[model samples]
Target: MRYYYAEHQAAYRRLGREGMTQWNDLFGESWTFDDFPNRVFLESVLDRLPASGEVLEYGCGTGPAACFLAARGFRVDAIDLIPEAITLARRFAQERGVTVNFSVQDVCAMPVGSKQYDVILDSYCLQSIVTDPDRAAVLAAVRDRLKPNGHYVLSTAMYDSDRVYEDDFRYDATTGICYERSTEPADDAVQLDNTWYLPHRRHLRPKALRAELEANGLQVLSQQGELRGDVICTPTRRG
Candidate 1:
């Protein structure tokens, strides 16, 4: 399967869960793609955000946090590889009466532009990357796009001591990806090094995650929450 094709399917099609379009049930029984807890995750890092400046958010599925930041007076540029997701995000921004720069671009190949941002937002998107190379590339892009004093607000799944892997899904400790390896393989099972498995999520252990970030020239300033939490980062000067 191609990268982000599964997510593209998740955009317009129903996963047969809460409702439609990857949103959660906020009220009673409904799914609004424009509204989700991911925005609340963004809000958790409010104290880290700059007063006013440009912010970059990668893998912004429907641009919930992007729209929220724009509404809060920050110039936002949100990107996701899925074109359909970006289309939906643009529509959602219009509905919210907020202006956000939403584009269909892969964060792994993020451009090195002259413009640097005040903040780079992860918002649980980092764990979805699911591979060492891709994660490294994306983190490098985040550091490159951030200003000297900019913050990298990251939220991702961490494999703590208590986290458990389900029976059906197989967890690759080395890669941190949980694969859907059922009796009947999924139609869209992705092949990595000739192994067919549909990656559900990636959980980075705290120690390794910190090392990876530091290797990519980002130093964690503070962190909060539990298994899935927010981390504030700043660029580390390399001699």
Candidate 2:
């Protein structure tokens, strides 16, 4: 892992730490009020999820979505790379009186288990695997973890617009990595006491994402793209 990723992973391990606290202070309440509205990319996934079943959430940061599903009577298992995130999620579940299992594990190296979930939710996490070398393995691991006929819900931001900005932006269609320079000032301002800089954003194009999913065992059911408009895609498992 690079220095940034290592630091991020370490910060994640201590959820109640200053770093996570600041992050939650910045965006926690927004998710707490309504997960569906804020998670625009996951709208399709939310729509396709079964009302009551075992649901696994990848990168389930802070567990708002898992809590939302649990409140609605679904059994949820939420996982994230950051331990601190998982700890906070667990606390959130306890506070809400919901039973949700939050685990701190890397998506790329998900532990083996006999059980498979009915639905798997991946909201804007895969896109964060910015480097080319890691994308294939991450996708494959997700596929292997899913049950046959299971549903994999995924949402990613696609950059295809007429609007232009005066910042450094780079997009690689082959690797599906999008890097954008940040314009935030260096004040070290704390959002929940987390002083991390938000520099680049990465995601896959619609076509590339579909291809990767299909190459694994997942088949596209319906897909929608949201820029100024909503383009949703929902895919079912193949055999």
Candidate 3:
């Protein structure tokens, strides 16, 4: 495996081991909060989708959005890198009596039929891939699996302002990746913070992100926010 892939896998394995003993509120009931902005953004974007669309939530940690969409009558498939997270998501779906196909899979190598989904959502997960090539592979996979004209919803951490990465985090100017790493391994609770588990992250400027997405066949339709960067785009060419 590549170094980045191995590093991410090991870190998440540690996270799974940690979650066995304690629950991080972020992936637990914290999703139940009514004002969760991601949920709000998702709910507001339903107008762009067809009725009862088939949806795929890539990197769907603990399946909140999957369950939410399933509850709203969409067919949902949610994939996450961590088995523990998938287990928790399945249990959460059962508790809510909502059906979501939760699978333990890596986004870079997704095992799904092409052109099967009407919508694909990546909620701040693409940056976790860290490297440009890996991110491109994921975008290609998403493009291949989306039906023509299907919407691709992306949420990412953007570093466009002077205040963005001024907080002592490490920034790689060559790659446009910004991150902070622990000298030693962080404990389970610490891993609950996405940065703790997947420490190597790519925080892109909006222009760069747009270029990458467009290069992968998506055309930007709408974009919002400098911090919680949300983009709504569609395939520029037939899938």
Per-prediction backbone clash count: 0, 19, 0
For 1-239, candidate 1 gives per-residue lDDT tens digits of 54446655564344233334443432345535545555666776677677768999988877777888899899999998877667767888998899999998988777777888999887668777766677888988888888999999887877766777776567878867787653445654666555566766778777777778889999988766666356788999768
TM-score of every prediction relative to native: 0.81, 0.71, 0.78
Off by over 4 Å in 2: 2-33, 36-48, 160-169, 179-201, 228-239
Best of the candidates, TM-score? 1
Q: Global lDDT of each model? A: 0.75, 0.61, 0.72
Model 3 lDDT per residue over 65-89, tens place: 7887898899998998777667777
Location of the lowest summed lDDT over 10 successive residues in candidate 2: 187-196
Expressed as tens digits, the lDDT of each residue in 103-138 for candidate 2 is 877876666677777777765566566544456666
Best by lDDT: 1
Off by over 4 Å in 1: 1-3, 15-35, 160-168, 182-195
Rank all candidate structures by their TM-score, best first, as comma-separated numbers.
1, 3, 2
